[model samples]
Target chain A: MDSKKGMKRREFLKKAGVTAVAASTAFAAPNVHAKTKTYKWKMVTTWPPHFPVLGEGADDLAKWITEMSDGRLKVSVYGAGELVPAMQAFDAVSQGMVEMGHASSYYWAGKSPATQFFSAVPFGMNAQQLNSWIYQGGGQALWDELYAQFNLKPFLSGNTGVQMGGWFNKEIKSLDDIKGLKMRIPGLGGKVIAKAGGTVVLSAGGEVYTNLERGVIDATEWVGPYHDYKMGFYKVAKFYYYPGWHEAGSSTELFVNKSKFESLPADLKAIVESACARANISMLTHFESQNNKYLQKLVNEHHVKLKKFPDDVIEKFRTLSAEVIGEIVEKDPMSKKVYESYSAFKKDITQWAKLSEATFYDMNK
Target chain B: MDSKKGMKRREFLKKAGVTAVAASTAFAAPNVHAKTKTYKWKMVTTWPPHFPVLGEGADDLAKWITEMSDGRLKVSVYGAGELVPAMQAFDAVSQGMVEMGHASSYYWAGKSPATQFFSAVPFGMNAQQLNSWIYQGGGQALWDELYAQFNLKPFLSGNTGVQMGGWFNKEIKSLDDIKGLKMRIPGLGGKVIAKAGGTVVLSAGGEVYTNLERGVIDATEWVGPYHDYKMGFYKVAKFYYYPGWHEAGSSTELFVNKSKFESLPADLKAIVESACARANISMLTHFESQNNKYLQKLVNEHHVKLKKFPDDVIEKFRTLSAEVIGEIVEKDPMSKKVYESYSAFKKDITQWAKLSEATFYDMNK
Candidate 1:
């Protein structure tokens, strides 16, 4: 695994503006009293090294923490497979193998079904409502309670605001079109497709492009136009769909080892939390700003047909999504508890949104 | 003005975990090297003391900076009229009479017409789109350049997401209904009212309710449900309107004296900026989380009639808004430059929004 080069004590002292006299005297004696101790942390993320906005957000989060702490706390970031595989990030941080990990919470559904609600849900609240529920409503307390069981503390770090549905090889004119289709989709979305009589295939990020190109998969759900354009999905797929119902405004997380985090000095702790908040807004805005340009290219340059799922088809998926979530909640008590709060907050916020955001969009049009 | 209680040196040292021996040695000589110098600053804001989310957000921003800096920087927040009148916030921070100021940008239109674009505009972008343009697009650089001319550095600090239009005693059925109406609106919205052949009356936050009740003004616009409910506008007006086309997703700002900000140590500077970002999201989420409950109260408990402006009337406002903005750009070169960037970004993001956010809202419904 690649590691960041360590900052020398002399260089650190110089950069931190410690006087030579103070430094020399502190080092002169074995039991010399010195300034506060410095902490060096390792953060492992699920994205490939320097991958688009997701991985880049992780790097920026680390940098902001270090900068805000004035070198008193330094963090080195590792991408997927560098320190551990992408799927292993949860355990790496939970087991205290790494100080922190960055990934979507749904990735840890195997650890706890309740975790998926913290990431995204089919027909879930959008980014603003989700953030409001998590940060201001009781969502954070529930998230904390859930993660504490696994010895982790989670922070809402970034968001992919209202992701596109996916790249489709054919138009989804009705529910019948979903039958017998072989598609690569993951998480609850995959289950919904399965319920609709489709064969769900699994493909890694690097392999999805080749799978679609070679007809190994009839369709694939990736990120929106920005990342999809980079994946060259438009080159392989004939049509793209709108309103990612399966993963609306999916939130990304930074999960740190609870013990390691608690051991931090108050300033470093405050600095870390604030840095995550900054990263959250920074990443969402970054995506919103660039997605349009890339979307334009996908439509105008690549001749990809942009299509909306049929209203009836979307209604079917909505019903299937409810059934999928209902079954999970029926089986898992924690999922029930989390989903109760999630659904309640979603209901109230959606009403407000209808009058506010929804009306604003409709009026402008 | 109330000030934050100072942290005693001994308490600060104990809290920061400075070794007793080091403290003794540092205090032994008058010329002893200290850990770092502390900064105590005053921040004047444009809201009443502890006014719901807006004023409370300023308090939180100061606390975060102090916590992150570990007592190296302590900021005292003063409400409007405590240090200076609400409208004088710009001059206070710009002239360095105060280290910082918090208010909406449009409050400074007399100082520069271009400043209004940074806050909100009639039928302009929403919160997500505005943030996209300002933070990631080239809007920040232009803002920095504009604020630099006034010796201030500004940060987009908070947002009131998709505000409510206003409370009206008379229903607005068409463009003719707006004529001869006296409304307590401000800035560009007031200008639009004037263009619609209405009389625009000026009233402070504290007087809006009384004005509407006494028929001094026939209508008034406050913030969204959370604040408006507290203001008891429902008790005074019969019809409440929706889709605040005038100030949709209005952004608030924190302006710091450029020279004072530059003088801060690197860590303190980073701490302050991150604190503002944390405050930005915190306030927006706070509003989003609570507005729905209060909105339900207004509609159900008090029977406030929630109304949407008629489509034709809204269209007329849109036309007039364009003309008003056209006059501004014609008169001011800075407004032209900023509006060019703002309008272009708005056009592109609005297109993307149609496919993403707008579609997501529609599909869910």
Candidate 2:
């Protein structure tokens, strides 16, 4: 934990009049002031303090829960490195160090490979399809089963619609172009790069710009056009590739300590769930509304060369992605179980999307 | 109002233990038992009782608000013709007859042509883009301004993704094929069909199947496969078409009476708003998850021939749609203001979609 950031967050929470209250008081008596009892909770996140869209979504989620509960459940949000390191968010929440945590599921892949399926899969469904699967197509059951192992309950909090591939110093014309390329990509996408004879350089968000500028990494995939533009990746790299095959529509999550969550009354529980659902759509729309404006800025004002990965190169990556995912599923039974549901839903929805969304795009064009 | 249905709904409300409470009690004594005061709100919707997806979404919205508020704000939902006719839902809410109303905005086109852009337009943005404009872009402010004229506050409550074109008895291979077509379509789509040399037959949902079976109408446009299959459109119409150009992604709205809404405390207002947002995403996912399975049944078991509208015919419809929208905008200042925002957002987002979503689909395939 970073002490300065932690102290700052503490001061902010104090200023908001949030005090540490006994959790048991909430369940003390059903009729005697139980409804009016205020439960102050802390939420730790994986992004920097109030980082655009992602971190802001966490802030909004906490705010909505607090507002809807009418201060009955006041939540204080701590950014990455505030109360704990970014990577420790899941563990902190699971161990009850914090009441809640917000981050993407792929970040917990080392703990459980099955976690990656909840966030995004290379060549998997995009935001709409992903939401459909999780909310209605039985994906939530598998997710609940997986997270219950860590004593955490998960909710889909936000999504960055279809992302751009990466910022490239050199154009990727074919599979040959991938060889010897040092790129700062993460999760399954990084594994695919490593398999394609490329060097997968691990860099933090703050380090990515410097690494790309210093030629330590030849490319890096951030988020979509809006975040990419905000990161000023166009200034460091020349070409921006399209159709982020590695992360079609990556989902962010809000995980709460199971014991703590179960202890809350039904009203607060409903408030928390509804807030997450609200945050889920709010974040996606936030990105969708601004991505195009920033995309136009990057192309017209910044002169970023926008390009698509070649068909053969995309094909190779797709093949590699499948192989990587297959290896993980084969080793982990839980991964296999989750992947079965995900792949089945994907196969069916892809066909329907072809006739609906895909065809509508063509007609509009 | 249908007295029989109204009596049944009132009985159901009574069975649920909902009673009419004085709204003024919620604001009196900000400190003393104000938090415990219950608000009983009636929501009249333009759908049959517990109708799949749409009506169910309304039900869920009310349920969530009730649960989140800890029964402090209990909402009772009524189906169309229960307290008022389907088309009268807007006036009911506007006139304070009901505290809330649920239906698509385009259903109120007779009230104001500007309402059409908020719901759907011919060749307009789909679910994702429309949500973007409404939630993040400046569309909400315009919507608020327009709905204020009717003494209502509107929220985007649900969406039905991209719909199928229609169930056609005859194939449409060219622009000429649309000539003299009798289609039971409504709103902007119906106007486009009329302009394309088709007779627009205004048939209610219950009458569509009979009218199509008796050859009174050659075509009809309903929702996507899930609802259409349930409606048994495949049995009467041989050719089901792809890419519903007119109603791309229709958005359903939840409107509350301005006076009633303004009377609520901050927590109840937040609860209602968050519930609507939750309902918005819930409905889209519900439709997306089931449409594929039902579509498969329609094509495989039912042996329905799925077809795409011809390029020339789609192009003709697109042109006529623009002309129809043009006339409305030309005559109405509010329509012009709303369309300016809608069209601009649509234009920009379309370009972004071309690179991200559209290209991603191609890569995935």
lDDT, each prediction: 0.87, 0.88
Q: On residues B1-365, what C-alpha lDDT tens digit does candidate 1 reach at each position?
A: 11222235445445645554353343322212233456678899999999999999999998998888776677889999999999999999999898999999999999999999999999998888888898899999999999999999999889999999999999999899899999999999999999999999998898988899899999998889998999999999999998798999898999999999998777778888889888989989999999999999999999999999988888899999999999999999999999999999999888888877887777655
DockQ score of each predicted structure, in the order shown: 0.44, 0.40
Candidate 2 residue-wise lDDT at B333: 100
For model 1, residues A271-306, the per-residue Cα lDDT tens digits are 999999999999999989999999999999999999
Instruction: Tell me the interface RMSD of every candidate, in Å.
Output: 6.9, 8.0
Residue A120, candidate 2: alpha-carbon lDDT? 88
Candidate 1, chain A: TM-score?
Answer: 0.91
Which residue runs does candidate 1 get wrong by more than 4 Å? A1-35, B1-35
- Candidate 2 regions exceeding 4 Å error are A1-32, B1-32
- Model 2 lDDT per residue over A87-126, tens place: 9999999999899999999999999999999998999889
Clashing pairs in 2: none
What part of the reference interface contacts, as a 0 to 1 fraction, does candidate 2 reproduce? 0.65
Residue B343, model 2: Cα distance from true site in angstroms: 0.4
Clashing pairs in 1: none
Write one digit per residue (lDDT tens) for candidate 2, span B1-365: 22343355446545654442222133211222346345678999999889888999999999998888877677999999899988899999999988999999999999999999998899998999999999999999999999999999999999999999999999898877878999999999999998888899998788999999999999999999999988999999999998899888999999999988898889999999999999999999999999999999999999999998877788888899999999999999999999999999999888889988898777655
